[model samples]
Target: MEAVNLNKKECKFVVAVDESEESMYALSWCLGNLISQNTTNNLVLLYVKPPPPVYSSFHAAGYVFSSDVIRALEKYGSDLVKSVMGRAEAICGKFSSNIHVERIVGSGDAKDVICHIVDKIKADTLVMGSHGYGFFKRALLGSVSDHCAKHVKCPVVIVKHPEKR
Candidate 1:
């Protein structure tokens, strides 16, 4: 067996996370399998919140939603972001404490946000979770991972969670 060199240049890994079990599984897998303890690794946890809903002051039903209702919707979105990030951070905490982690929250289409952020941060690799959509479904839904794999400058890893029997 060849001896391995532990000391190497630092690598930045950008992981795209969302409020999904698949994403969390991908994050855990990346931490356990890909990250090197000897080299300084930057783990960037990225969550892209959906763009705010566009609602006219007057609804088609001829009634306008109260400001309170709008505020509640906005609050729910904010809370969801916090919840996802909190879970991601908890996973990181369970992994090697030596790995440096950063949390980035962006608002826009997920595919666009992920690709743009990966390019902007100059990530060495982009990691994402595969939802395992069927060909028909994926074609209709437009897979975000597929888009990132083609668009992002860095290499992209799409981890698929093993299905339980």
Candidate 2:
């Protein structure tokens, strides 16, 4: 295992977050377990947005999709980013205020974008949540954390939420 740079004042730690409860669990776990509540560190929260909607040629035949529709979609995407980031910030605030949180929004496939950002930022670690999907479901839907773990050069931690009663 590679030794972490404990001497660095602000080692960057990236956490992939979304609206899912699993992601929220991962964020909370990272704050409480991996990071010190009293020390200041660079905490990056990453969110990947889906690619913009592509309009088909068929739509131009009868009537064009108004720019309003596109704007609305963009607005919804922005709102989603804000909502998820807000929740993450709240979690951090509850745990500790010493962490300096940075929000990063990327566009593209989740797996690819996450790997790219982790490399680009030279982050110390990448933390993500596991959906805990069964084999068949994972095989069908694919697992973002699985793909990221293989591609990211830094250490990847996949946090699994405890089962509810």
Candidate 3:
């Protein structure tokens, strides 16, 4: 395991964006620390979208889809997007246009995609939230932040929990 000695602000940074509060908090931390009062650096906020569920058979289509379910899903997704956008806006609000801020939506394993982007973009630093999930669950389920910290070659910054943050 690597030690916590990241100095990401000196180089281009990539921060993963999810609907989770942990990731958001970590993003906030990156914005506050990495984005300087007068400097240009790229801050990419990535949001990973889950692959929509696919119905197994067209025969079930005749049974009529629940409008509520559809509405619920739409609302859920929209809310999620808005939340991330809001966090980004708050972080870069004070920065000049030179500070590149972007929102990317993708569907895939967050870890693989993040590592790929980090490599392709040549990002030197990565920042993310802890998701507050326990270490055991993180080891078993594989947290997004954890995956990035493990796979991405660049330095990673993980926003700790509220108390620690």
Best by TM-score: 1
Kindly list the per-residue Cα lDDT of model 1 for residues 1-165, writing each as its tens digit.
Answer: 955445557888998888777788889988988898667889999988765543335556778889887777678778878898899999999985578999999876778988999999999889998762221233256888999999999889999877621
Model 3: per-residue Cα lDDT over 19-68, one tens digit each? 55676677777877777645467788776654454221222346545667
Candidate 1 lDDT score at position 122: 93
- Candidates by lDDT, descending order: 1, 2, 3
- Identify the candidate with maximal lDDT: 1
Q: Where does candidate 1 stray beyond 4 Å?
A: 1-7, 54-63, 132-140
lDDT of 2 by residue, 47-158 (tens): 8876553332224356567677767766877898999989999998897457888999987677788899999999988999876222123324678899999999999999
The global Cα lDDT (0 to 1) of model 2 is: 0.79
**Model 2, runs deviating above 4 Å:** 1-6, 37-39, 54-65, 132-141
The 0-to-1 C-alpha lDDT of every candidate, in the order given, reads: 0.80, 0.79, 0.67
The better-scoring model by TM-score among 2 and 3 is: 2
> Positional deviation of 140 in candidate 1, in angstroms?
6.2
Superior candidate under lDDT, 2 versus 3: 2
Prediction 3 global C-alpha lDDT: 0.67
